[model samples]
Target: MAGGLLGTDVVTQIGIIVRDIEKTSQAFADFFGVEKPKWFLTDTIDKTQATYRGEPCYGRAKLAFFKLGNLDIELIEPDEHPSTWREFLDQHGEGVHHIAFVIQGMQEKITLLAGRDMPLVQKGEYTGGRYAYIDTVPQLKVAIELLEND
Candidate 1:
């Protein structure tokens, strides 16, 4: 198989979809013997953009991140919206939703994946970075999220 446009194999984060961010984050912290992860509401995300099945849609999630070694363990609680997270939870239940990789030249990478028939599912910007989720479940059995941090 060919390598991705990012030209790397390292996973930056493993995102898990949940029904409740607070409960799930607490449980993860307890199981891992770490402090409770901080939560961020999707409504606070800036420059957010997303599409579902090629149509514009609105979705929100409450998210928490716990750094584990070189990668983060991300928990996402889908809000009342039609988003990829919500769709995943509805179709597959609570589980691993996507694996993330940090990359440079995000637009070029997105174009490359889109050329390969992997459409962008969702995207948003945060404090110092932005992220895009690509729909790759049919071929890879999981979505791929690309991150570009400033």
Candidate 2:
């Protein structure tokens, strides 16, 4: 608790994993009458990987970004890869993956979380942004992303 923080305590950006990124993104747009969000295929993603339980795995995914009422909504379509998202989708279709939070003092947060022995599910840089997924739920669990310039 010293270096880490409660997810609820952080202002969050919610991302929903869906069977179809286009469909879900449109749904949000239609409901709010907002413009359709831009889409991003896995090929376009700056980085892509999977996590099985909490280790490196292989898979494909489609992602998109949109803005609604100051909230950035992301649609993720997990491929048949062995990723945490894939597991979630397999068990529960498409749904909320994580409540992402952008933080200042990011490197500090990373060190703090690591110092506490939290296992990282995935870590990498993409599209000029650096991010890490920490499975704070037990040893291997859901990820809380610290996306920079997201």
The candidate maximizing lDDT is 1
Candidate 2 off by > 4 Å = 1-12, 43-57, 104-108, 114-117, 137-142
Per-model C-alpha lDDT, please? Answer: 0.85, 0.66
Could you tell me how far off, in angstroms, the CA of residue 142 lies in candidate 1 after the best superposition?
Answer: 0.8
Residue 121 in model 1: lDDT: 79
What root-mean-square deviation over C-alphas does model 2 reach? 4.1
**lDDT, candidate 1, residue 62?**
85
Name model 1 segments beyond 4 Å from true.
1-3, 44-46, 53-56
**Model 1 per-residue lDDT tens digits across residues 1-150:** 234467778998999999988899999999999999789877543346455556665777888999999999999999877888998999999999999998888888889899998888777776688888998888899999999999
List clashing residue pairs in candidate 2: 59-81
Clashing pairs in 1: none
Residue range 1-150, candidate 2, lDDT tens digits: 543463335535676779887778788888888888777655323343434445555655687777656577778888876666676699878777776776665567767777778656655556656666666656535557777654
RMSD of 1: 2.2
